[model samples]
Every structure is written in C-alpha cells, then in structure tokens.
Target: MSAPRPPAPPAKASGLRRHRALLARLAGGPAPEAVILGDSLAAGWPGPDLEAATGCPTLNLGLPGDRVQTTRWRLAALAAFAIRPRLAVTMVGTNSFADGDGETRVIAGLAALLAALRAAWAPPVIVLATVPWRESPPGRSEADRLALNAALADLADREALLLLDCDAALGPDHAAGLEADRLHLNACGYAALSGALAALVRGA
Candidate 1:
C-alpha cells in the first residue's frame, strides 16, 4: 500500500474558513451577485481588475488539481454555504487533456459537470470558461492541443454555454499562456486569461 498522508495541517483544517472568508468578502455579503467556480486558473484570484471591471462581486471558488469529476463531487459542499448568486463560472479539465484523455472524453466529463450544476442551483447564466493551454508531454503536439481546445469550444456552443477562451486570449497557440513548467500560469499569463474572462462577464 502507499504511504498514508499526514493528518490535516492547521492551514488545511482552516482552508475552508480561509476560502469562505475570501469569498465572503468578494460576495459582498450573505449573497453575491456572481460566483466563479473553476480550477487553478480561477483560484489564482484573477486579480482585482476583474472585480473593478465587472462591478460585480466575483468569487473564485477554484482549487488546485481539481479535475472535472471532483468539481461536481464538491458542488454539494458549496451548496451548504447558502449563498445563491445570479451566475456561476466553471472552468475545469485541462488535466484530462494532459493525462492522455481524448477530446471526446474530456468533453463528456465537462458535459457531466454542466449537468450537475444545472441540477444543483438555478443561475441565470453558467459561463463555461474554455479550458486554457498548458503544453502536453511526449506524445502530444500543438495540433493535438488545438484540436482538444477546439472541441471544447464546439461543445460549449452546442450547449449554449458562454465560451471564454483563455487560449485564444493568451494567444492563438497558447504560446503566451504557460510558465516554464508547461503548466500553471505566470502573472502575465493569468492576467491574460482573466482579462478576457472579465471582459466577457462585463459585456454579458
């Protein structure tokens, strides 16, 4: 068997509290006008510019290493928080593309996530933020990356979900998106995607 992980650290125990505090502030009270639920990109805080740009309380409920399945599984947790907002933003599953899952599988996972969101809360808008770019390893190429991203765009269209393409915003080829690790975002990259996302929400 694998080694057991250590007990939850203090920060870990208080993590939800921290997240709640942060979100509570963003929400502007017991209820928020909008909430953005996504992956690491969403969790990166997306800068204060978005809040000013949209003029709405935007909560980023993103966590690191969150796959599409985990996001749905965790939705119930958010339900317990008791704040209903007009909109919820969802961005997930770039990891699926990296781990050898095909575009079809990734889109299926995304579809399931959307279904869960639909069942849980009633929001006027559910913006399906398009999966951003981070280069895949050995067997993946730029074309493959483009293909999967393109597939997500199409899926969003068919579902009538708003598409916020971080890849396109970062650059057509994601050339401007990632840091040296080929994953995660630098400040510039984060700003790039957040700028587009903020603009999308503001205009919407």
Candidate 2:
C-alpha cells in the first residue's frame, strides 16, 4: 500500500508562484495588445480563445483571491513593465464582496483600480460587472450583486469606461452558466462571455 500523499502546499504559496510566473512572462515577452486583469475570472480566462476571438495578443493578469484593492496594488507591477496595452478587460469586485466589504467600499476600490489603470496605460478599459457566485461564499447576496453592478455601471459612465453586464451573457439563470462550485464559469459560459467581449474589442 502507498503511503499517504503529502498534504498540498498552502494556497498562498501556490498563488505566489503563479504571480511570479505571470510577472516574468510579462516582463520578458513582446508587449500585449490587450490585457485581462482582475481576480480568478481574469486568471481562468481562456487566453487563446480570447486572442482568437478578438484578434489581439492578450495577457492575463488575473490572480485568484484578488479583491479590488489587490488588483489596485498589482497594477503598479504591470505598469512597471514597458508594455502599453491598447485595451484592458477587468472583472473583479467579487472577492471584495467575499471579504465582507460593503457595497460602498467595493465600489470605491473599483474606482481606485480604474483610476490606476487609466493612469498607467492610457487605454480603453472594459470593466465587466462582478459575476454571480454560489451561496457557499457567504458574503454577498443576489440583491447586493445587482446593486454593485448598477453602481459599477454608473461609475463606468462617469469614467467614460465600457461596462459589460456579464449577468446578461451568463443568462437570466445564473446557475446554468456556472461550474459545480457555482462560482466559476463553465465552458458554455466562457464562450458566451468571449463572444460578448469580442464585439466590444472590435468596437474599441
């Protein structure tokens, strides 16, 4: 009989490695034409599909467990690189919710992040409203998410940013588009999101 497998590394350790790898890739490669930045959704995005769908060389700067404040902090690292992305897609804020932040704080954090991205890259920013997540997360409610999205939309308008209502793409029934965890997207959901984003990228 085999010995019990070693316990897995702490998630924070694994996340650090992933961040380091992404940074090295960004620092070494050709400048990306488009970038997807935010939280896990940004990290989990099918880069090849997005590139294929949008006809852009894309970079994914998403980090798991990233809140709006975390994204704001990470922006400085991306800005340190010489690259200037023509377009940026952001899908964050859910982690902020999960962190027990109220709607006002989450919106403020998002505003700050958008400000930093604009200052750093001077690109057209596409901000996707926070996606629906499962009840297990235990910090946000459907009503709160909708309110957050509405606030984000208003902010986008004032900031002259493009706000994509991801809920619509995910469909009226949220669970159908989500994975077993009911937080992340399934293939069909991703396809729908990518298709919606392709149109915006073309317009940009």
Candidate 3:
C-alpha cells in the first residue's frame, strides 16, 4: 500500500487564532526557563511535575495531532513572540509513523523542526527525546520504531543536540507506564520522563 500522506497544515488565520492566547502569554509573560514542544505527550506532561523537576518555570507548546510540518508551522507563529528559553525539549514523530511516514521522511522532518527551533529560540541547550514505544499499528512495527530511534540518535549527534532515549527513562518495564492503547504515556511514564528531562536540563 502507498504510504499515507502526511498531515496537512492548518489554515494560517485559524491556526494563529487558536494559539493567540498562548502567543500573548509567551510574548508578555515572564520568560520560561524551559520550553517543551511536540504532540500530545508533551501537552499532557504535568506542569507541576516539570516545574518540580527543573526547579523553574516551563512552557509546554505541544498540541494533539501535530506532525512535523504542522509543528514547524507552530514554531513559525511562535517566532513572532521571541520567546527565549534557556532549554528546549521535543518529543514528536509517533504521529508520523501512524500516518505511515517512512523513517527517512520522519528523520528529515525532525531535522527541519530542529533547525526551525534553533533559529527561533536559540536555546542554550536542546533535548531531542526518542519517539516512545506504542502498540504496532498497521504499516508499522517495533523494529521500525527502533530503526527510527537509531537514526534519530545519529541525527542528534550530527546536529550537536542531546538525545534522550525514552526507553531508558521508562526502564525495562515500560509497558506499565503506557496507557491501555499503548500509544500515550500514563502518569508513571510522565513522572519518569520529567525526572530524566530535568536531570538533563540541570546537567546541560
């Protein structure tokens, strides 16, 4: 079967309107010490947990159903606010796999997203979290996920970005940390992820 097409970009006017309040806050609010970007996983991360982990304010810019292209668009909109963060973390690409995108395309997309992030925020340090495990969807498998993550590691090295392996954070018993659908993280998963992320930020 042909690979499923990537997600289409949202209309500019509506997209901007949807995030207007957030943009306003980013523009006006005190600069966050760290900013998290990506899809639902990023959005669902508890703010309290993150703050407690990093010992500072953090802004999460994750949106449900976001793909690499759409995320790039979000970054473009956010550029206007000039939100300067000390550290940035991103966890995306599972949705792309669900969309049936191949590893090459996903990696290229991530590289672009990383470039956009650096150009826009220029954070002192950037963290690229490996795509977490999920139940094998049609046209995807565990092997595919591992291959993509391996590529991501190389990408991080090439880009000089720190790579955070989600599996390592979740530990060997990661299944316990996943939701029933096995796609998104449960509270336990988030706890471990946030703790690892915070440690990285502190050390970076």
Candidate 4:
C-alpha cells in the first residue's frame, strides 16, 4: 500500500479571520495571567471555569481542529500582542493522530510548538497536557496512545515543563467523561480537568 495520506493543510485564512476579534481584544486589554492553547478541547473549556480554577484572567487560544503545526502558526500571531502570561497550558496532538500522523512526527511538532511558545510568550510556567484517550483510528491501537503519552512525559521532562495526564484526571472510567463520539471531553471531563488545572496553578 502507498504511504498513508498526510493530513490536510491548515485552513489559515478562515481560521485567522474567525479569531481576529479575539486576538484584537487580547492585544488591547490588560494581559491575561494565564493562557490555554490547543484544539477543540481547549476551545470548549469554559472561560468562567478556567478563571475560577486559576484565580486569574485566562485567555483561551484554542482553535477547533488544530494540529501542532496549526498551533505553531497561530502562536506567531500572538507575538504582536504585548501579553505576558504567567502560565500557559497546551493540549494538542490528538488531531495529529486523527489526521494519520505517527508518534515521531507528532512529538517533533510538539517540541517545536513548545519552543515557539517560550519565545513568544515567555511564560514562567508552561504545562503540556498528555493527549487524552480517544477511539483509535484504523491501524492504531491503545498501545499507540500509551506510547505517545510516554513520549510526551519524556518531552516534558526534557523541556522543563509540567505534564498533565488528562486520562488520569478523567479516571479509570474515562469513557464516562468522554462525549458520545469518544474523541472529545464532555462536561464531566472538563470539570475534572479544570479542578486538576487549578491545583497545578496554585502550586505553580
């Protein structure tokens, strides 16, 4: 068989247009104390919940369907903003798997994103969340997910970033926290995540 197809390139035009207002506000307003970055999971996280959890203004820069590459591009835009967040949380890479990327590429992309984030935001604390469990695509299995998480742990250690295990926060019955599609988190899942994140922010 031919090599698996690569993921579609990010729809930069539409994505940037959609987020233009939010970016402007972020650039114009008082800087947020924390910023969350990722795909749908990060986008859907309630702002009130995050503010309560972190006890500070938090900006969610999540874009649905973003891969690591997409997030890296998105981060470049934030460079124009004079925002200096105290903390930054990232929950990306799952979309990469859905789009047929393997462990090595995903890890490399994540590392690059981290480097870019540091250069752009210079946050005192950076949190790298483990990709949550999800339904495996064809030719992938739970073992692959575990391996990716393990690699993420190594990446976090090497980069001096805190690692949050989303699966552990969701607990052994993680499926209950997942939505019907089994890919994204539901209310219960977000609650768990918010609580865990609060604890981390307090300590950080």
Q: Which candidate tops TM-score?
A: 4
Ranked by lDDT, top first: 4, 3, 2, 1
Error of 3 at 136 (Å): 1.3
84-127: candidate 3 lDDT, tens digit per residue: 78888888888888877888888888887888888888997889
Each prediction's TM-score against the native?
A: 0.77, 0.88, 0.89, 0.91
Measured by lDDT, the strongest candidate is 4
Judge candidate 4 against the unseen true structure and give its global Cα lDDT, from 0 to 1.
Answer: 0.83
List runs of model 3 lying over 4 Å from the truth. Answer: 1-18
lDDT (Cα, tens digit) per residue for candidate 2, span 1-204: 222112122147776677778889998888998888877877787877778756789888888877776677677777888667778888887766776667777777777777778888877555555555445457557777777778778777888877667887778787887788878878787887888777766676
lDDT of each: 0.66, 0.73, 0.81, 0.83
Q: What tens-digit string does per-residue lDDT give for candidate 4 at 134-177?
A: 98977788998898899889998999988888988899998898
Q: Would you give me the overall lDDT of model 1?
A: 0.66
TM-score of model 1 vs. true structure: 0.77
Error of 4 at 116 (Å): 1.0
Candidate 4: 10-residue stretch with minimal lDDT: 1-10
92 Cα displacement, candidate 1 (Å): 0.8
The predicted structure with the larger TM-score, 3 or 4, is 4
lDDT of 3 at 69: 71
